[model samples]
Target: MKIIVFLGPSLPRSEAASIIDAEFRSPVAQGDVYEATLIRPDAIAIIDGYFGFQPAVWHKEILWAMTQGIHVFGAASMGAWRAVELGPFGMVGHGWIYEAYRDGRLEGEDEVAITHGPAAVGYKPISEALVNMRRTFASAADAGVMTVDTARQLVQIAKRQFFPKRDYEAVITAAQLPAAQAADLSHWIRRHAIDQKRRDASSLLHWFSQNINYLSAPKRVAYQFSATVFWAQAVELKRREMLSRYPGRKLDHARIEQFTRQTMGNADVQCRQQRLEQCKP
Candidate 1:
């Protein structure tokens, strides 16, 4: 069996512990959720429920998994966006394909699109959903005419609530509501979905700027905190895997931290470029 580590969306310490403990040899050994620091597991997976709203953060992990040859997948919000943006990495989700192209990572000159909205959760590749989402967004954008900002917000709102077969209509309903009403509704959805774009970037940036916050500060802090948690988990996994390899060998902690930092540094740089590109006209 492939060893997968689910990351993102700060789960309750107890809930995260349940998944990690039930699945890994030591769930709370070093208090981390990622399995990479200590073990070169055969495969790793991520749950979008954790990081679906934060696109920048989600992309880093997706790219990291892809580059490392790990099979990565996402479910909603962050997952839906990545399933399309990093489809080259292979994924599964619905909606956000247009935004993926808007960011410039998902490019298929061939218009060969696919839709399996009615399939089982793990059965369909997210790439198919991306194609379908593109069409849906295009229609939603053009239907009954709306401001570009409204359309943009609609796409953003759709990211978190987008489900393969079940919640698609709800996504559309939310997307089609007047921009003002939709804004209020987004707060409710974001509890389980991330649609930061619903609030104009200018307003958000303004609020941050007024408070002397750097553009990257919130995202960076989130990255550091989550990465630290993941690193800790990975270290424990590595130690145990090493023990399995060498019956009584003790594992090294410093080496794991160094390795995790190096890998994360590379992901940070790449993700920075992605965020910059997404802001381009």
Candidate 2:
């Protein structure tokens, strides 16, 4: 059985698949985790997910997946978001992004959120993530491309822009350092705009490959999962989606056609019989 990975922008399908031989699915949305658990995969790694307009994946779904004997792991992007909240409950969190969230050093969903292109383009990122910004600036300071204070200023410049419109060029321009300093910082950023999300995602993938057998281990949650009204409602929605999609139920076109004809014929006979009885004198 394949390990299921809920992935998107952070790690491209081709690159991530090469790192770990697992099924790569698109970013998790509202009901994705609950729906994925129906297959009972050995493990799941959530690396990226949807937000805004569409409903984001629920924390309860990740917990539910863990309770069903599946190893649930998360990192980078939305994965980092979920893992922080659910890590104490057996959801594995990986990478610096997750560490930041867990330690309360990095707070806020926007830190990881970035606007990107569609899947056809491999979710080509159009905006910079705050996580990447922090990494880039830290590296800049450490590398002497900028002073510690300068790096902090550039990071703040990035924070001022909306997440969707954020980019290295725009942020650097906003920094307004001296001409020589700006030139050095610009060259450094161009060469080293580390994509922290992708890096963290890769780390989780490596971890997933090394710990394949961990799926069988029992979790020690502080409490058991109760089917609260909210949880039940979410499950109901997932069930409806599953049923509507006709999962595992297949009828060939000819068989469906025959069934439809037989149904119509039965209706025709019933209608005629009723008319005949009504007209009887």
Candidate 3:
């Protein structure tokens, strides 16, 4: 069975591959899944994705993949968020993080967002995920590493920081815990911190591996995909990008512009042209 997994900082590629043998790609961005559908893999598992710095994978593309009979599974970071939003539409969600979002216990992307290094460094995390910090604080409180009040204070501090700057050291410093207690909590965290994202990501990979046989069969969905003008534009952009990769493949720009105008209507076309002109220096 052919399966593709979009993965990144939530878990290392080597660790995930050890759990499930599949074609693993870097964190998914806009149009990535749509491009994957061209390959018609039996199933696709989304564990991590790009946002903020890049366009995120679109829900329309995922629905389109399902309409094409490809099974879609989501969990961990971006996957968990998309799964909760698209579950009723046929996307299968797995792991505790997915459940947390589905049940409304978690409501924001900040819970999963973490700053990380480039893919060349295996997307090394430079900041802690709020979800992991929450879990770790709770665990520390249960283990008597800190008081329940202290744990709650830490959570609040972590939540207030922007995701890119959220980390244990910052939270602990902001909380102003006693020096000895701070040292003890830090030591405990280094030893027993719960990496909820990685755990959920691994669960997703394992679940996909176990169900590969069943997933090999075509997926059936109850909804029909509607290709709106935006989706068409995305498709056209992808086509042009693919064509640009080959030499001597001349593009008919005028024809493409005509098609765009027809799909987007003259008013929208004019608005886009005005915006383009405004950007000129």
**Largest TM-score belongs to which candidate?**
3
The predicted structure with the larger TM-score, 1 or 3, is: 3
The positional error of residue 39 in candidate 2, measured at the CA in angstroms, is: 0.3
The residue-by-residue lDDT of candidate 3 on 162-230, one tens digit each, is 999999999999988889999999999999999999999998888776766778679899986654546
Task: Provide the overall lDDT of each model, using Cα atoms, as 2-decimal numbers.
Answer: 0.39, 0.79, 0.86
Which window of 10 residues has the lowest lDDT sum in candidate 1? 213-222
Tens digit per residue, CA lDDT, model 2, 90-204: 8888999999999999989999989989989998899889889999999989988888988888778888789999988888778777788878877888888899999999998
Q: Residue 272 of candidate 1: its Cα lDDT?
A: 37
- The reply for model 2, stretches above 4 Å from the true place, is 218-222, 243-281
The local distance difference test score of model 2 is 0.79
Model 3: CA > 4 A from native: 245-281
State the lDDT of candidate 1 residue by residue for 135-254, as single tens digits.
Answer: 444554455334456655655554544243323345547667766655544443333332222111122222323433222221111122234344333344445666687787665656
Candidate 2, residue 183: lDDT: 84
Clashes of each: 11, 0, 0
Best-to-worst TM-score order: 3, 2, 1
